[model samples]
Target: MTVPLLAITAWSGTGKTTLLQQVIPELNALGVRCGLIKHTHHEMEVDTPGKDSYLLRKAGADQVIVASDRRWALMCETPQQPLSLAELAARMDSSVLDLVLVEGFKGEPVPKIVLWRRGVKGGVEDLLDEHVIAVASDEPLQTGLPALDMRQPAQVAAFIARWRAAYR
Candidate 1:
C-alpha cells in the first residue's frame, strides 16, 4: 500500500525544518513510523568528495548506494529530471513507514500544512489552497483552516497522528 504523504510548506526562513526536527521525534514517541523526503533548490551532494561512493558516482555511475550495518543511502543522479513528491515517496519502504512528511514541493498535489511566522515577509495566504489541510503559525490569523501552534511541536505531531489515522 502507498504510505500517506503530507507536506510542511513555508517560504524560506519560516522554520519548516526546525518544526519538523521537533515533530518527527514526537511522532516517533507516539508510535508513528515516519519517513521524510526533503526538496531543496540548491545542488546537493550527500557523499563526501574523497569517499569511494563519491568517486564512483562522479566517474559515471548513474546510481550509487552506500550501505552499512545500520544505515544505507541511495544517491541517484537525475540531472535532467526532478522527481515529484509521489515519485520520491515511492522509493521508500512503505510497509515500514506509516507516513512520509515532505519539507517542500508546496506546488505538489499532496495535502500540506502551511507554516508562517509573524514577522515573515511573505504572504501566507498565497499558499492556502484546497491542498492545504491546516495552517501552523507563530501568531493566529484569520484563515479559516484549523490553527496549529508552531511553537508546540507535540500538538503538531498529535494533529499529524490524527490525520494519518483518518487517512488510512
Candidate 2:
C-alpha cells in the first residue's frame, strides 16, 4: 500500500519548518514512521564540495547514492526539471514509512496544511488553487477551512490522526 502524504506549506519565514520539527517528533512518539521532503527555490547542494559524491556529480553522474554504517542518502542531479510531488515520493521507501510529510510544493495535487502568520508578505491566498485542506495560524482567516492553533502540537497531531483514521 502507498503511504499517505501531506504537504505542510507556507511562505518564507512563516515557520513551516519549525512547525514540522515539532510535529514530526510528536508523531514519531505515537509510532508513526514519517519521511520528509523539502522543496527549495534555489540550488541546494547536499554533498559538500570536494566530497566523493560531489566530485561524482561534478564529473556528470546523474545520480549518486552515499551510504555509511548509520545512514544513507541519494542525490539526484536534475538542474532544471521539476518533479511532481508524486514523482518525488516514489523515490522514498514506502514500505517503511507510514506517512510522507512534504515541506513545500503547495501547488501540488495533495492535501495541505498551510501556515499563516500575521503581517507575512505572501500566503496561500495568491495561489489561485484549492489544494489547502486546513490552515494553522496565530490569527483568524476569513477562508472557510478549519483554523488550527499554531501553538498546540497535540491539536495538530490529533487533526492529522483523525483524518488518517477516517480514511483508513
Clashing pairs in 2: none
Candidate 1, backbone clash total? 0
User: In candidate 2, what are the lDDT values of residues 23-67, reduced to their tens digit?
Assistant: 888788777778999999997778999987899889999888899
- Best-fitting candidate, scored by lDDT: 1
lDDT of 1 by residue, 102-138 (tens): 9988899999999998667779888888999999999
Alpha-carbon RMSD of each model: 0.8, 1.8
The window of 10 residues in a row where model 2 has the poorest summed lDDT is 122-131
Q: Which runs of model 1 end up more than 4 angstroms from their true locations?
A: none
lDDT of model 1 at position 34: 94
Candidate 2: Cα lDDT at 164: 60
Best by TM-score: 1
Any idea what lDDT model 2 has?
Answer: 0.83
